[model samples]
Target chain A: MSSTQQTEVGYVVSSRDFLVYLDGLPTIKVNDMVESDTGLRGWVTSTFEDKIEVLMLDEGAIKPKQEFRRLTNRLGINVGDFLLGRAVNSLGVPIDGKGLLSRTKTNLNLELDREALGIESREFIANQFLTGITLIDTLIPLGRGQRELVLGDAHSGKTGFLIDIVVNQKNTGVICVLASIGKPAVVVRNLIDTLRLNKALDYNVIIATSSSEPPPLIFLTPKTAFTIAEYFQKKGKDVLLILDDLGSHAKIYREISLLSNKSPGRESYPGDMFYQHAHLLERAGNFLPEYGGGSITALPVIELSLSDFTTLIPTNLMSMTDGHLLFKAGLRSQGQTPAIDLSLSVSRVGRQTQDQMTNLLSTRVRQVLSAAADLETISRFSLELPPETQLILKRRELIMEILKQDPLTAIPKQIQAILLALPFTTFLQNKNRSFVEKYKVIISEAFLKHPQLIPITKSITKLKTDEELIKLLEAAGAVLAKLCP
Target chain B: MNEILSIILKDTYSLTSLKHRLRILQSYFLKTFFGEIETSVNMPLSPQDSNWLKSLPSSFYQKFNKDNIYNIFSGLEKIGTNTPILTMHLAFELNDTTLSQIGAFTRKTFDSPSLLLDIKVDPNLIAGTALSWKGVYRDYSLRAKLEQKRQELLEEFRKFLR
Candidate 1:
């Protein structure tokens, strides 16, 4: 239909905070845009027989009996490559100090909410998505286009770990988009500053909304972030989209739903709460070349309460995503920077993307770690153990120490495999915990430099078994011991 | 319709007319409930209120107690808010005769005798009407016609100027 025939107008009959009930605009559908006389914008959320509910995008001087014009289009935001390295709000307006987004570079306004393409439009997720953290890279890997939930309690290093991933994407050709939804203003600034300090800002896009904005506006931040990521993905560039805490997004939706008088179900959230999150998350996937070919690897963060993963939002997210990586506050306090609980974490798609050698090696590492955990509990009750059991307990402690990496350091896939395999080799028997801590980087650097170890790095691709890879490192014992000493 | 509502229903087809007649009815009821009709020495009703009382059915005398007066005012106020209105924009302000004629035409054509008129004066309409109902607005004004043939009119004006 022509814009003229679709034209409708409404007068505000009643208003409460950011929500206004209009008496006309009978033809306005949900997600349509509306604006008041003074140019305040809103999204049409619910339509009744004679009234429509609009959640205002901005807090303005709106009063009863005010006329609002129906905008011609559904709700959408302008997007472009000019958005990279800049921070923007839910409206696609630049919030960074740099400048405005160049309108010429942007495509026509793209609606934020979109359903995932059908199965025919998608390909298998077969490439590993590295996050520089050795613990996750080896134990709980994630794949391109995978939707992995990064969940943790307060001070569990979730934010720090996410920043490390963005920083590590520096030269990898992967575009990073971080959505800081409903965070404090200072926290958003801190995130941007960390990216800038690492010189990672130029390749990343930050879509942020502070808690003080209107609830509906704050709630649109993740959707806006996804839209910006898709803009880059359309050109077949890989995108790592991080939603830094969807927990706040759920709360904001609950607030809007309750105020709109929708019936609140479990946790007083609206009945469609699961659908709201599931639909947004379903947009991420490895797509076939017919549909952009590139992938959107989404790491949606959720802050848990007291490390309880059984809560409504966390469990709902678990069932929706490919898998989750659980971060813990206790581990953070004990000097584990990323603080991920590998035993609790699972990756359904990442293992498929791993090389045959790395796959076998990680399985070996996990089996050993699991056995050590069981024996440690029993060793505390008894006084002594067999010679092999004692060695196994000692090896587990050394493996844990090697995995406890500092923030902002990214380990390569080969180096991560080599590092995890160190505890199993006899080379680690002589090296003390303090010795390994000081020279681990030196040992890792030797993989590229040392004469004997350099060929092992190339030979890793041909090695079929974890035992062969471990024996190869053990044979280069003189070089490893010299580097550590 | 209640006899009290019917007293002004025929004349009260517009929102402005409905409010004006309801205000008069409210005063007539208030004055009579205070014993103005029986004692004749109570507060005096204005000419409009007195005319309203004269138009009321004689049985209204039996229902003009305190409770009925409240119910009658509440029901009229409810109608004032709930009534569907058709807005008319005209080149000139409406007079009583033109408003009643438009109201009668609309009531018969739309089959809603209780429908209300919300009149707006827009001189730019240039001697024709623009109407809005149920949020849909359309221009049937002379201004709209002139704009529709704007290029032809401009050519004629240019010829005259040359």
Candidate 2:
């Protein structure tokens, strides 16, 4: 459609916030681009028997009987290597003021029917996508193609967790796509700055629709991000797509639906809300080798209201995703950096992808933590406890301290394995608690610097016996003790 | 000058005579309950459109004597605004025949003879006519045909080259 053509003129019948009901054009599709004579840009959202509702892309004055023309093409974005390290809106227009992206354009709503691909086309997710966070890498290990929901309250380190994962993917060769829907512009800027500071921006693509943007664009951001990720996925490259939070996305959809006169189902959310999110998340999976053997790991964040997991959006996401990393507000207050509640958080398919050594070590850590939690509860009621229980509580304290990692500092999987295995060894046993605490950094540093340990750590995944793991841990402990002493 | 007539041009076959009847009814309504017609017509309906019946003013009940006012607004809502729709399909420029055909189609499509046809051109259609009447869009263009048989055409071209 030529932009110069004055082909179809529609007059606005009624004007609402971000939505205008126009009369005359009856053939607009759900996502057809529409532009007004007064320079207002929008897209057709809903079509009724007689009227069409348009969601404005900008906050321009739309009076009654305003003329609008339907653009011939559907919404699209430029997707290629040019998008890497750049910030763009849902429309793929560069918002970072870095100038226009001159690349081959592709339709934003390219549908990938996973159901038609059949079972044989998809590979078994056997490889681990390490986040470098000890808590996540060990306790809730993520498979390359898994969709994990990160649930937490506001300011509970949810974004920080995702940023850390993206930062860790820097050298790992995973193309990271962060879709910030309805986030403040400043927050998006800060996130981009953080990525640049860590030099991870080279491997990152930031697709953002800020809070001030129209609801339609905000709703389109995540889908656009997924399309970009899919573009790279088809090239046999792994992509990590992080939707910062789906809560705001859901709210934006609800707003658009209400403005379009759609009936609200639960909590005033549109009825198709569940299907809306499920369809987007369903696009992510590990494809077969014939399909380039690529994977798009989606880590969709959901902010909980008062740490309530039973809410409408959270429940819908929980059911759709593989499992969730529940970041507790209480844990955050207690200074647990990631604030992940191990008992509540789980990875349904991650254990299968982990090495036997990691599996063994994580299992032990879980047991110790669970025991400590139980003891803490029991000791709260009683003044005294058994010596073994006391020691378990002490070990838990040290383990918690070890898990307190600085944001964006992603520990290598091998390093995480070594650090986790230390609690089970004689390195901290019988030593003064303070002395062990003080020397913990020295021990980790020593383990990280060992040249022989790198190859041994790589081979640890192949080791079959616990006896071999125990011997290796003992040898590593002896070396660490000598270095830290 | 009636707001209803101005927005309902394309669906004039049924609404043309009804538009005259509504103008009379609207004038009478204004005389009895000044500006109430605008308020009643512009009142927000429930998102589901289920509560629209009950949300009507009680004064409308006494004045209209029957539920004719409700029926009129509901009908008005269905036909939408009277803006004439003209959808044009072109390979490039709007030829004389295509322009005249579109003009004739618009006049015949709507009850209001004064309503102008809205024209939109799609160069992708290659050569054909695509019409948007009332709220429906129909494409009778060669471009659409090419798109439908794109794969077959590609194969045929490849065979011809061989």
Q: Go through the candidates in order and give each one's C-alpha lDDT.
A: 0.85, 0.75
lDDT of 1 by residue, A1-485 (tens): 22343347788899988999998777778899998878999998888986889999988989877878888878888887778889999888888777868847536789977666788988899999988888888888889999999999998988888888899998999999999999999999988898989999999999999999999999999999888888788889899999988999999999999999999999998999999899888889898887888899999999999899998999999999999999999988888767988899999999999888889888888887998988988899878698888888888777888898888898887788888888888899856677778888998889978878889888877888888989988898877777665
lDDT of each residue in A1-485, candidate 2, tens digit only = 42232245577889888888887775577777788867878887677876887888877888875668777656666578888999999887898888877644452334322222456768888899888898888889999999999999888988888888888887778999999999999999998899989898999999998898778789888888888888889889999999988999999999888877789999999999998899899878899878878998999999998999998999999999999999988899887899998889989879999888778878878889999988898888877888898778877877777777878787777777777666666767666456655876666666566775555576676777545666787776666666776
DockQ of candidate 1 (2 decimals): 0.40
- Location of the lowest summed lDDT over 10 successive residues in candidate 2 chain A: A107-116
Cα shift from native, residue B34, model 2 (Å): 15
**Per-residue error (Å), model 2, residue B21:** 15
lDDT of 1 by residue, B63-154 (tens): 66787678768876876677778877789988777888999999888788678888878898887887778887677878877877788999
Off by over 4 Å in 2: A1-11, A23-27, A103-121, A380-387, A451-459, B1-162
The residue pairs that clash in candidate 1, if any, are none
How accurate locally is residue A64 in candidate 2, as Cα lDDT from 0 to 100?
A: 70
Give residue B150's error in model 1 in angstroms. Answer: 9.0
The positional error of residue B90 in candidate 1, measured at the CA in angstroms, is: 6.1
Top model number, DockQ? 1
How many angstroms is residue A45 displaced in model 2 relative to the true structure, after the best TM-score fit? 2.8
